[model samples]
Target: MTSAAENILERPETARRTRLQELWLLFKENRLAILGLVIFVLFFSTAVVGVILTSGEDPVFDPALIRLQEKLLPPLARPNLETLAQGEAPRLGVYLFGTDDL
Candidate 1:
């Protein structure tokens, strides 16, 4: 057999790359893909951080915990003296999209 034919028949001993790794390599070559990746990461990180920071006892689950005086509070609405006296804070846990019912 010719040397070229012998070389073509030989298998390399190095480990093969994974499909995901290969895809990532290809994805990194595109500028738009990199931008999209960054946006996705930022959104994901924001969601994760919001969840972590918002961790607390949820009052919506318990009917008894609901205060009629505090119902239907607007977003970023400052707590009144009466509400504060009853141990309520303004905004009620960073309502990013706002909440009609508190």
Candidate 2:
């Protein structure tokens, strides 16, 4: 019968789908794996978005322009109000993740 033939043809696909569903259920049972998956997705999306947004501009930063005088500053080293008044701080934005000069 055509119904029997259709069932036979679909059996392998149904088995494969059941296996994939079982694997997904097993994966969801692990809290740490879920957290890691979330973190990975966030980082991956951030990198992809950053690349797209910066595509028109220079892809690489010229660290050589970063002066020796301005090197090795800690993160968020905001100038004091007095220093700002005196115009001592670099015109660049806040150092959110500290300097890369070690």
Candidate 3:
């Protein structure tokens, strides 16, 4: 007669089947918990992919354009006289929802 431990060790497929059966039983007993886990994983994957895709390029500096008049300006601040006289809308990088404003 074979021992119980020997029988389990002899069949690797049987061990996998046993584990799957236990998981199925647990899922059946806690359906909502399993569903919540699936939803969380889906949202986490979407957020990670979005961050990877939407990052912007680095800004280049122009030493000639760096005048004392424009020093210490915050981002998306009002445009200087040159930009206004040229009739060009101030380009504040991408807005979250794609509006002209910052």
RMSD of 2: 6.7
Candidate 3 lDDT, tens digit per residue, 1-102? 479889888876734457888888888789798889899999999887666554546223222233344455565556466633342333443122322211
Candidate 2 lDDT, 1-102, residue by residue in tens: 999999899876534457888889999999999999999999999889767644654433233344455556687765344534344344555655456664
User: Which of the two candidates, 1 or 2, achieves a greater TM-score against the reference?
Assistant: 2
Candidate 1 on 9-46: residue-level lDDT in tens? 79576888999999989998999999998999999998
Residue 17 C-alpha lDDT in model 1 = 95
Which residue pairs clash within candidate 3? Answer: none
**Candidate 3, after superposition: displacement of residue 3 in Å?**
20
Mark the regions of model 3 whose C-alpha exceeds 4 Å error after superposition. Answer: 1-16, 55-102
Error of 1 at 15 (Å): 6.0
TM value for model 2: 0.48
- Give lDDT: candidate 1, residue 59: 41
Q: Which stretches of candidate 1 lie over 4 Å from their true place?
A: 2-16, 58-83, 90-102
